[model samples]
Target: MLLAILLPFLSFMIRGKIITGIICLILQFTLIGWLPAAIWAALSLQNARAEKRNEKLIRAIKENSK
Candidate 1:
């Protein structure tokens, strides 16, 4: 079971293919259980929100500079 989940990630790591790696990771998490998926989803959402806030701050700084 661990091998099954690790295979895709290992392949992706070898190939350095990020999209497939992420897809495989999500699939593995889903197949194993929902907790990891939920935690990662929450973290992803938080990071997205942080990025948006950073973008807003950057825009404000640019506007003030102008």
Candidate 2:
């Protein structure tokens, strides 16, 4: 919940997704586009988290097989 609200700002501050953050920042200024931007940020964050989880799981499986 809180993450969705802060993601756009954090993305820019952390320099993770500069382009997406910039687009969201610009959309935020429009007021109406803010929701879409936030939604986009949230979805992006979710995908990143899932990818990280997958990587960790793969690493664990590889270590156990050895």
Best by the TM-score measure? 2
Q: What is the C-alpha lDDT profile of model 2 across 1-66, one tens digit per residue?
A: 366665565654464766767777888887788778777777777788899999999999999999
Steric overlap count per candidate: 0, 0
C-alpha TM-scores of all predictions: 0.53, 0.77
Q: What's the true lDDT of residue 53 in model 2?
A: 100
Off by over 4 Å in 2: 1-3
* lDDT score of residue 58 within candidate 1: 100
Model 1 per-residue lDDT tens digits across residues 1-66: 232233544445444557755775666666664445444444544665699999999999999999
